[model samples]
Target: MPRKPRTSNISRSDYYDITFYLQHYACFHCRKAFKQSFDNQRTQRLCPQCRQPMTNMGTDFKAPAQKEVAQWRKVQSLAQAGIKFFPQWPDGRPGERPDTLAEIPAFLKQVHPPSEGEQMLERRSQEPQRPQTPREGKLSLQGFAPHQTFRLSGKMLITGDGVQVFHNEGWVNAEVSGHGNNPKQPSHLRTFKLVGNKLYYAETVPLDGTLRLRWPAT
Candidate 1:
């Protein structure tokens, strides 16, 4: 039998730590950080554009330079990853992908385990989740006609620092949310994982802020 690859320790920065790691760190695969580090194993991450996931090749993974790591770094304001994802391509789940390198410590603040100090399970038991509440949010559209049906077709592309949305109708300043291409739900209610150049997420739960999501660009 072959021996499993050695799981290496990931020296963490303050920004990317999560409760999963007592020290707090995200899994290269899930983009969801962990407290416990996996012994040099592979993992996966979801990409917003193609609606496909990427992976991390543990063998070649290494700490990058400050400038290089800057790409994966979390912008304080826009909430996007400064670094890239691992695996380089799409082998689907639990495999090679790009590096989701940077994040703010606040982003993963809610992910800690429950032990009286962290409150992972305790929080879950306390609060049941519901869908997004309709706050008095504003929608500034460039060419979006009210009640129009525009499909991203499971393929939405966003670039640049400022927010720019291109719906089937036209472009505007807005973000996305959902679980990717499921034709069942109404497009508006489908719940997409957002995309932006300086994007960052506050939580994991698809519907509400249970995973308290955000991408504030600094």
Candidate 2:
């Protein structure tokens, strides 16, 4: 008889250890209740559809956790049978299942709070300040600091009465040289330039072509 081929054996403990490491790599942004070996680990950190980062979250995998997951699945199954998810939580005390995709941002934020740049923005927004009004019917450029970093991109149109009429941030106002109410419209109108900051200037662009000043008259 031909000699039987020797088979390499993998110990159950070894297999379990490998399983634990692959199944739970200290996830920081998402929980992995269950994963199958069929999933390729190399591309695990990105979504297959949108190519977005996938979060790995925290978990305490014990009997109580398993029970919670079981209860959640039971409720989710019931809801799939046309049960309303929120009206008193269609599946008794267990409640509804979260949409994994919808819950990603919350998970990531929890895992990784604001970085230094984002924290700086929060500080700037919270800085104490006062609102300013325009001067001399014409916007006095003196008080308003020029946006030096990025030059303003929009146009300025003055009202016939010498007022910089309507204003909006990052938009330009169209002019017909002097103020004559747009022929077809009840209110005089102007379209804004798509690029500049409108906040420093007194001009404005209404959605329907009419520009009105948002600043207090000087």
Candidate 3:
């Protein structure tokens, strides 16, 4: 006699982490609900409290009561609007239909009462659809140039040396070769990062006021 084919072994990469926080299962014997994880292979799922084998309730085991009602109402509305259900798939399971227009009132009644789904669907279908407004455009600084001068209140002060100074016909780098108040004058470069809507500099301006290079002609 031919031996049965060996069960396929899964690779580590093929097995993904399964988190079943919201999903639940019921014990086969006691029918008590319990949360379960399918991460590791188990010969039997014995409940911690009952020690009974548990059966999977599947992914769609539970849903919000409101959402279920809303969905069924939508289906009933479509059916009432002259829609007909299409043929089901060849291998489809029960309660799972390819096209559900024909299953309206019955399918809906299973989830809700006699007329709740129908009433909600009728009320929703008659309400006027609101038009959505376009969102406001955000200001992008793609072409924004860095501020060459630091302006406070109304007084404008030169940033520092090494800044572009307007010259006779073109721009030239300002003299920045001195330590203190000597021949070339005190000069230092300041760096800043833009956070949200403001530019924040790393270091504060020195207490010793540095010389402000005269602004050249435009």
Question: How much does each candidate deviate from the true structure in C-alpha RMSD?
Answer: 27.7, 18.2, 23.1
Clashes of 2: 19
Q: By the TM-score metric, which is better: model 1 or model 2? A: 2
Deviation (Å) of 134 in candidate 3: 89
Model 2 lDDT per residue over 1-218, tens place: 99999975864323434455333221212222332232334456554345455332212221124335544443333333333222132433323333443454454455457799988998999998654644322222212212111011132433322223344443233432222343212223344344464423334333222233333344
Residue 138 of candidate 3: its Cα lDDT?
24
**Can you tell me which runs of candidate 3 are displaced by over 4 Å?**
1-23, 63-218
What lDDT is obtained when candidate 1 is compared to the true structure?
0.32
- For model 3, residues 1-218, the per-residue Cα lDDT tens digits are 99999985752212321442333454434535565566357456677677876544443333123335444444335334433232224643224422344566565555455577877898898999753532221211121123123322233333343333323444333433233443223334343445798865533332122323233322
Worst 10 residues of 2 by lDDT: 144-153
Give the range where candidate 3 is weakest over 10 consecutive residues by summed lDDT.
135-144
Off by over 4 Å in 1: 1-57, 60-66, 69-107, 119-218
TM-score of each: 0.15, 0.22, 0.21
Clash statistics: count for each candidate:
62, 19, 0
Query: By summed lDDT, which 10 consecutive residues of candidate 1 come out lowest?
Result: 204-213
Model 3 alpha-carbon miss at residue 15, Å: 7.8
Give Cα-based local distance difference scores for all models.
0.32, 0.35, 0.41
Best by lDDT: 3
Tens-digit per-residue lDDT, 110-136, candidate 1: 332236745666677689775453222
**Looking at candidate 1, what is the lDDT of residue 17?**
29
State which candidate, 2 or 3, has the greater TM-score: 2
